[model samples]
Target chain A: MISKINLAFSQCKKENRPALLTYTVAGDNTKKKSLEILNAIAPYVDILEIGIPHNTPVADGGQIQTSAYRAIKNGIKVKDIFKIVKQFKKNNLNKPVILMGYYNTIFQLGERSFLKHCKRSDVDGLIVVDLPWPENKNFANKCKKQSINFIQLLSPTTSDIRMKNIIKDSHDMVYYISMLSTTGGRLKVSAKEILKNYNKIKKINPKQNVVIGFGITEKTISSLTKADGLVVGSALCKTISGALSRGTNPVRTAENMVKKLRSKII
Target chain B: MLKLKKGVLLIDQHDKNYMYGGKFGGNFIPETLKKPIEDLTNLFGRLRYDKNFIKERDYYFKNYVGAPTPFIKLENLTKHLGGAQVYAKVVSKANGGAHKIYNAVVHALICKRAGKKYIVGDTGAGYAGKMLSMAAKKFGLKCKIFMGAKDIKRQKPNCDAMRKNGAEIVPVYSGSQTLVDAVSECMRYWVSNCDTTHMAVGSTVGPNIFIKICAWSTAQISRELIVQLKEEFGGVPKKLKLINCVGGGSSAAGFWNEFIDYNKSQVELIGVEAGGPKNSKLHAAPLTFGSKIGILHGAAQYVIQDKDGQIGETSSISAGLDYPGISPLHCFLKDTKRARYTSASDEEALQAYKLVSKLEDLSPSLEPSHAFAEAIKIAPKLSKDTIICVNSCGDAKKDRAIITKRLGFFR
Candidate 1:
């Protein structure tokens, strides 16, 4: 069976532009508001990257960290994330939904139980930021057996040998961390350097669906149109944070921001 | 070969090819930190066994930090307890008033040799911070420490000691406002400033490479103990019991490292954890009660977390013992039954604190007071001929203010 993640990538290929992947904390501020925000922004983006709002997100920068803190303070639990995904899938949305966060959250719920929850909730993929290659092979295989995509992350620091090993078992897509920094840090490296590394991975597995994330704001999205998808996480979360601080409607604000970012891709 | 069981990677304990047997240690850091951690690991491996590095460390240990701290028998306390013969490894006699100076001195030397301009660390009780500050000053390097706001308030003397030694203290206000938060903040700081700063992790609780490096540096405790036992008892005891209180478990790891290869049935290793106050949500004994294996501070270990996997808030009168996680090495030992894990209540530790101060005329820090409390309980239960060595790793003079406040002396 073709997973919704693969289908989404294939649809993006037909549109002749990089897919727009937007990430938001699964219960940021409030569970109700988080669901509303996800529904509002889903149509404007190709894939919905829902964060599980863990207490420690080591790979994320300040913006995502603050968002996760807010979400956790608002009493977001793991079951609530499954509930939100089930609600989103009940709406018959075609956009693939990926649950992204650290490994401890899923490890707390046994891997098998977590995968069963994902299958029940219709979660298309998982992006456990801390579960790097080789160490993650067994869990990745379990994810594959359940027909859920276990996305692999590639950074500039990933050596050639490690890259070959990681790509060998990587399924659905590969997440290329754009720079040697966290998710929201400044994009200091030029576009040429990013493409240089991106093309290197492509040479290794040209057919693998590769997406670029980190430091991709609306303005920077236009510069990174050469990949299969562009993940805008901290930018969108920062927008929600700013809207909440100003007492504005975060759902409307994030929807407008995603629409504008999507407009920049083409 | 590694096996994944219940989301935990299990490795063979006898695997000498891997450091610490990948079962206990794994690098779960961010991508940006991989290279820096690797660099630190490689530098540690090179410097750890080098002749010049050994000479320099020995010179500093003897002249600067005062190595081979006295291992004296607490004759009065043992007589009063009326049971097993008790001894104390007095690490407080070492420089900076604790055994943590050994690691600080070694890590600072490593950073200085690596050409790093700044050293960063996180501390719970502030002893590590003060020691690192002294090491940084001796090595002529800039130093910064992340301390929890609560710990900064509780450990004011050590905080002042760090500042007096020319180290900047960054108060962390995240995640229960404690040691775990301080560690998280310090790691974020290292991630951003890794080019110029080396993270001198305060304990053997972080990534795999860090644990190995710290274990190497701290092996001095056991190494000295081996010689001291030989001089006093003519040889290592056949029925020996080593006890130490564990927070991040560096002292316990150091004290037990050499003895792990010994016959397990002959030597008994006991690790005491903070049991907090009875009938209160203030305990930090993860190994004693916590069953789930989870990742915290980069390494997979037994973590005291809530049902939803949220890191639990830990509490102890002793700031050093108030942590949500213990070192992964402690977890492995506890899992294999190589060591017995137990807890001492806050009230029990306080009683032991006073008893040791009065009987032995030695004011022990609350961190080691937990170990004393356990010793008081178990020493009486053991045979009179049995030998139990309690690692009195900290001096209670540093906790005078907090102790006075808790005892209501001001009022």
Candidate 2:
């Protein structure tokens, strides 16, 4: 029973490249434009991560915040997000789709109901920014029951003891927050420093799929290609924001940006 | 927990595993914060019983914070109400003119002990920021205070005072630009620089470690009150009601810390939240309104959020009481039926401020005026032997502009 998420990582590992992951708000510009953007970027991206727009995304930086705010203003509902995922899964190639958000949205939907939606929409993974280890154990178990990969996170500040606990409970993949900052923060710590820490986590369990996220822009993505996977969120979100301001379709711009990111990581 | 020479208990003996207890107050922060949070938890746990730390804390509480703040009987208000005897534990006598400095002092000292030179904090009405700035200046640590842009304008004097105390003020302009956003931004900033910085959370509404730290530090108020009660009434009186305003529940936590173990028949605790404007639909009374359980900032508690779980916009004339969430301790207390929760509307709080000023010749900050309003409402219904003690948690000087604009007298 190999999950699409695991398959993506395995395929990338076989190809000697890190899996390319892209994150965008579910209804960033509009309902239709979001679907178009997802479709346009699907070819280059190994894993497509959709953000559930929350009013207060404290963990997210300005670019992702703006995308979330736009989707929220458009009155995008949770069911609407599931619909988008279902449509994207139906119309596109079989790439893994991971829904990333804070825990409250899932709490609002109830763990069972939210997992049901995820299962129906063919969502392969979930990355709840707020639900870290220990507290997330119950929800992670619930996510497992639905066969969805509940991605656990590890940060540089995470001690080896806690890192072991998180990795043990992690599903198919684990997300390594590159630094101790919100998404889209400056690269305060150099790539060498981040990878040094990443390599330690890797040494703890080499077989586990670990992806590096946060501050993964074009300039930095190439430097991070040694990791199992790379997540580019704010950069692609900034592309969408730029396209909207210039009165252009974000689909092509997002596609091109993902292609560029894929080029670097692969 | 040590009982210090100044007749104060450092921490509650029964508060075992206060960080994540009984379905509330877990550390729900990002993994980047796990190290600092755990480090703080361990340090605070060790310092609670340390004799040297207790002595140093009491030294500041007595001389710097002006502790054992006058427990003055409100004779006029008691006679006017014609039922219960009223008293106020004047926490405004504390340094920074609010109970906030209690937490600020402990956090600054903790930062100093942790060997960090930078301390960050968040403020809604600027009390925590002002207090943190003063404490940081005293401790020779660089201070950064995150405040909402909306608060920066209304709480200008406090902001100016923070600047005077040499603290850098970071204005958070996102998501209603109020206390909640300030806290969010402060936590966001801490995620990056936590290795060398200590985040002095303004209230007991954040992560598990912060909630416990705030509750433990602010418990100094109750340590003072326990002795004051015996001094005032010769002993603990029958039908004692302890009231304090509940925003993030710091003042109330401090006010009722010792009384938590008291029998329900002996002591009644009341927490008054902001009920917003009288005719409007918005309010900050989450616990009173039976807000659905949801996670906000870093803990799971009763929060005002939509069915979709988006944190709702909250409003109150007092910026301090305008947060959408409350302390997890209060949440636990409310569930256990150990305390009563209520709300005071903006109009009622303003009216209480006017009445108390005319009668007591002492004005309270809008935050505590809500508690006073609750006391005023229930005083007439009780017996003459019933004693009502309200923690006048802050001075009214901070609300001069809003008071002048609303009721036309604070100028």
Each prediction's whole-model lDDT (CA): 0.86, 0.89
> What DockQ does every candidate get?
0.44, 0.73
lDDT of 1 by residue, A1-266 (tens): 88888888899899899999999998998999999998888888888999988776667778998899999999999999999999987775677999998888888898999999999999999998877766688899999999999998988878788888889888989999888777788887888899899999999999999999988997788998999999999999999999999999999999999999989997
Clashes of each: 0, 0
Best by DockQ: 2
lDDT of 2 by residue, A102-216 (tens): 9889988998999999999999999998887887888899999889999999998898899989888888999999997899887778999999989988888898999999999
Error of 1 at B66 (Å): 1.1
What TM-score, computed on C-alpha atoms, does each candidate reach?
A: 0.93, 0.96
TM-score, predicted candidate 2 vs. hidden true structure: 0.96
Q: What is the DockQ of candidate 1?
A: 0.44
Model 2 Cα shift for residue B305 (angstroms): 0.2
Best candidate per TM-score, number? 2
**Candidate 1 wrong stretches, greater than 4 Å:** B1-23, B408-411
What lDDT score goes with residue A211 in model 1? 95
Candidate 2 Cα outliers beyond 4 Å, as residue runs: B1-21
